[model samples]
Target: MPKDARNQSPELDPVIHPINRLRICATLYSAGATDDRQMKYSTLAELTGLPADTLSKQLKHLEGCGYISRAREYGSTRAKDTVWVTLTEAGAQAYVQHVEALKAMTEGL
Candidate 1:
């Protein structure tokens, strides 16, 4: 077995793996759908306290996993386009896992 691997014990909580992904998913989870509440790139960066480049990489990863949807909305004229972020169905589930991961990482020592 590798130094770090899934625990065979069913007693242990089946969460807390992939801490980085959990953090990313947690941030995305807080940002609801555009229809519910549009989330801007800057806002996400501010809320997560992550740099734009890091956020961009995370966004691309999440989008590839079918967890989040990123859209560049442009107005008719020439103007700064808006970047919209929304959590997909998979994202919602991943968010739940992320929460569970936190609990597992910090529950009862």
Candidate 2:
């Protein structure tokens, strides 16, 4: 492998390795490809096809790892409230590095 590819050989991130967490990170990363974007909680739930509780649990784990951040916006009615999720800078870097590492590991296979 080239030096650059070798340099990319970091371990797959444990925090984002789980299938659900990987899906969440991938969606968030692609959604914000052009800019630092935030996705609504409901939208994520729909995309992931995960039950609310399960998604919440996965998100909580990411947040605890400093890989994601969440904010709540309140409207006049409780039903109008929105929760937004964004991948943090550190999170983005970690995700990219993990992908690179995967690529590196598979280069000669």
Worst 10 residues of 2 by lDDT: 28-37
lDDT string for model 1 (23-61, tens) is 555666665553355577777777778788988887787
- Ten residues in sequence with the least summed lDDT for candidate 1: 8-17
lDDT of 2: 0.86
Q: Please list all clashing residue pairs in model 2, or write none if there are none.
A: none
Best model per TM-score: 2
| TM-score on alpha carbons, each prediction | 0.66, 0.84
RMSD of each: 6.2, 3.2
| Candidate lDDT (C-alpha), each | 0.64, 0.86
lDDT of 2 by residue, 1-109 (tens): 7878646556889999899998998888888821367899999989879899999999999999989999899988989999999999988998888788777778842
